[model samples]
Target: MSTFEQKILSTIETNQLMGSDQSAVIAVSGGPDSICLLHALCNLYDKLTATCVYIDHHLRPDESALEAKVVETHCLKRSIGFMSITVDVPAEAEATGDSIEACARRLRYNALEQVRSDVGADIIAVGHTADDQVEELLLRLIRGSGLKGLSGMGFKRGRVIRPLLEISRQEVLAYLDTHGHEFCHDSSNESVRFLRNRIRLELLPVLEQRFNPAIRSTILNTVNILKQEEEFISAESDRFYRSLVRECTNEKDPAGHHSISFATESLTTIPAALRRRLFERACWETGCRPDFQHIDTIDKLLAKPVSGTELHLPDGVRVVRQHDSLLFTKLTEDQGPRESVAYTIEIGQEIEGSGSYVIPVLNRQLDIWLSDSDPRDAQLMRIDRDTITFPILLRSTAPGDRFTPLGGPGSKKVARFLGDRKIPHHLRHLHPVLESDAAIICVLGLEIDERCRITETTTQQLHIRWVKP
Candidate 1:
């Protein structure tokens, strides 16, 4: 076996990119790197099965057909399976407002995944050399990426594996020449319009000659160090997310949206680095493509006393502060305003006896009963039955509402009262308030009126409990 084939086999073994007797879908673009990978894998037919998939991004209408034929002919000569697909990247880019490069990459990977599934393959292999890795590191660095992005591409991500990650472009070209194999050159690679092409053709050569002859190796070393550190941070981030963040289901539109919540108070306890990673993970889980500006904005939001503040981000994501918690939600097209709609709690004759009333608006249930003794639960509120007249009025808070909390000095506006308790501004108006004979009784889940508190001479005890879903 040649040195290139030995390196390929070694990389596969070291990274465990694929197991013996497994099937792989190879992404072949008829380029030197891809053709090299396909030829090497075909030579290892004893270890695994390989299928070639050529995806035409429709960017080069004149050249794409010929490239597909080249790859197909090579696969046929090697007695390997081959598939061809065409994706309209331009249409997708226009529809999603993404750059042509970004859209093409997205569609290419998606097409490869679909092909892998259709072929019942275990993994999808792509030819990404060490040169590509160096370029990627520079690209992400120029684009202002974090540790994870700076770490560059991995040998294996999900079902996609890059067996040529350790090989150089020079090595790939040498191997193709030795084997006397022909490959197509993409005209786009020579265009300086794309940042990657410019970096490859201009920046890389200049850096190698003018700055350091070993710039590629230096960048690869930096990527290796960053990848190790990022792995440790990623593991810690996962631990913190599992322990601190929680997924919240919207009962009204459970299938339409995705949401995640974490306590705002916990932000102070976490390191800034981990916090940013946590935010990114939360955004990704909720279907948002997080960026540096969005994350920085969220960090600033945490430092301010901006309860109920909200930020609408890309991909229809909405981030809001609700009292003590920060919520990340992927909003659907039909998702209406997040402001809580005003609702009234109608207490029927059930309030006079033991019964439960569902508060659909708040996704909570209120339980009331005339008790002979205290429930002793902190969540249960004990009231003096004789102190207030029934035909109790339960409704959302209104302006000018006032209540004297139990053991409090005097009455205060309901708005200020809730504010003091750190209730979110948007939810202050939606907070449930109980009234008896035009006298404010209590704010559920907060404090009860001092006038309605159970006393030593109280004859009847009224119990109120709030249950949340």
Candidate 2:
């Protein structure tokens, strides 16, 4: 067997990335690395069925399609199954607020997975080589990544495998030359606008010429050591994470936010490093990006053991403490106060999002008759009809909006009031408050303005029933 075939077989066996009976899907882009990988896999693993896939990012419309055709023809000439997909990476980048490269990578992986499922493939092989690994290391280092990022991409991540990770780009080109194989050269790989291209074309050459002649090998060795250390730490952290976690529940509402709780005592006992990793994993599970500041905030909360403490993280995920437990929920944008619609209502008019009804009743007897206790009585609020002016403005809590909650002394911030009730920070915006002539007469669900409380002398009442949509 040739050296290229030997390396591919060794990488596969070392990682145990595939089974002999499994079919493999090769993500080919008609580039040298992918072309070399497809050729090596076909030659080395005759026992395994293989398919070649090309993803057209649609950035270089005509060029990308040509590359796909080259790859398709090569696959067919080799008698291997072939497939091609096109993605609008620029439009996706705009829609997702991600960089074009990031969006393209995400869409590419999604498309690859879709093909994988359709073909019932066991593994999706990619052509990421040691050169890409070194470039990624430098990128992550500049971005302030921790050990996990320093480890670089793994040989096997989920169903995606990199059979050429241990091989270099020079080696791939040499192998292709010896085999007399043709492949397309992507012009984007020369663009300085992309960090990877800059590193590959300019930075690596400088480092190799001036610093270390074998910088690529040196970085790969470092990544290998870091990856091993990371694996041990990850396993230990996962063990501790499972021990500390008590329950995870999702809100039944459409927002689909999750509620994750950990034992406060057990959490405080964990080492700070492992605890941070555990919290980071939890935040990632909830689709929130865990930063140092947010992780530190949670660490402080765990040490202090405050019952009602809460932290609002990025991505609209709310973390609330209920006694000894922490609840994580993703607050939908529609559930937030920023999306609130401001409107004025007269007698018998209803609030828009709050679903509260305002009905004018004649007397205390009529108030009791209309307010026969329903299952939703807890959401109902009663106020003296004569005390409020017409056209009361119904809106979400504004900054500095203060209200005296029922049976409470003095006024507190609407935000603070909601926090005290264990409301997820993101949902507080949806908590409606009624402003009558610039005075807060009610907080839709929790309390009625103390001044608006119905009394014995009040002959008429404005009955408000809070309903959730």
Candidate 3:
């Protein structure tokens, strides 16, 4: 057995990458590293059943096809099962709003997953070397990554195993040369436009020449240390997380918004590092991005002694500090049953303006206004007929629209009122408004104009109802 084959076998056994007599899918890109992996896996074990999958990202027209053909011929000569799949990476990138690299990676994994399911493969093996790990560490560092990100890629993540993670690219090329193996080189790796390529080709050589001659080994060592430390922290954080989270309910309100609560005192008692981890956990569970600034803002909120403080986080999540608990709730969409399309409504005429808008009769019997109204209710205000004009326009909120919000000291900008309420920016245009004399009388599903409020002297009322969608 060659040195490369022996090293890979040892790495696999140490990592327990695959079980004895297991089926594996090898992702071969016709590159030196992948070709080495294929040969090593095939040569090292007879019990292991392996197949090759060549992904044609369709980025390069002729070169990509040639690379696939090379991989196919090699697999055929070795009596291995081979499959070539084509993906429109550029089209997928445009559709998903992802960069070319990100989109290609996502689609490639998806295609591999499909093959894994089809073949009932126990694991998928990819040729990611120590060089890739070093590159990733630097990439994450430049991007301001946290501990988890800094740990870099693992030898095994889910069903994907990297037997060559401990091996260097130079070692791979040497192994291929010793075996008289032919491999296809991707020219894109030389392009400076891609960050990874630039890091691999430009930054690495300069660092090796000037700073550390063994920078790759240094990075690998750092990654190993950090990975071990990060694992300990993550496990401890999860243990504390379950205890800190007092209540988690998905069926809280009618809208099915998820709510999670943590004891304020208990949360603050946690170590600063673990506190960040716990907050990150909450953000992940709530489908919110765990941005450093956002997490810091939330962490700072825990220090405030005051209660009833509310913060609107990204992804419509609202964090509220109660008396003894911190509450996190994903705000439900304010879409009401009423359509927000603007149309003029005549007095005493009932028109189904939108799904939420309805004109109810002036009962004046059942006192719906005697008690505090549900702010989310889409009910029409009781405006005196004589005090208002014949035609009251119900339209989507527009610029320059102002309203005297009920119980407010004075008139405020409709936009300002919506902003104060923590309404999401995208949903602002869908908010309905009732206009009279070029003035906003009602900001539907929120507040009615103070002037339109019912009084004892009022003889007639125009009841407008706004229902939550």
In terms of lDDT, the best-performing candidate is 1
Q: Model 1, range 29-129, lDDT digits (tens) per residue?
A: 99999999999887855656878999999899999999999999998888789999999998987565467898899999999998888889999999999
List lDDT for all candidates, in order. 0.80, 0.74, 0.74
Off by more than 4 A, model 1: 246-256, 332-469
Candidate 2, residue 281: how far the Cα is off, in Å: 2.0
Per-residue lDDT over 1-469 for candidate 2, one digit per residue giving the tens place of the 0 to 100 score: 8977898899889889887788989999999999998988888877668878899898998698889888988898789899888899988865544678888999999999999999889999999998889999998887678888899999999999998998988899999999889999999988999988888889889999999999989999999999999999999998887766544443444555565666665666778889889788878877787766677766765665556655555555656666876666664543322211112234333222221132222111111111222233555577776667544566667889998887898899888888899999767755667776578988766788888877877765566645532
Give candidate 2 regions above 4 Å deviation: 246-256, 304-306, 332-469
Q: Write the per-residue lDDT of candidate 3 for residues 1-469, one digit (tens) a residue.
A: 8766788889999989987689999999999989988888888876667779999998888798889999999888778899999999989765544578988999899999889999999899999999999999998898798999999898899999999999998898888888799999898888999998889889989999999999989989999999999999999998888766544433464557777778888887879899898878776777676567667778877777778766545455666777988777764434221212122222333222111222332211111111122243334455544355423465666678788888899989899999999999887754567665556667766787888877787665554555432
Candidate 2 or 1, higher lDDT: 1
How many clashes (backbone atoms < 3 Å, residues ≥3 apart in a chain or on different chains) does model 1 have?
0
Q: What TM-score, over all chains together, does every model reach?
A: 0.69, 0.69, 0.69
Quickly count the clashes in candidate 3: 15
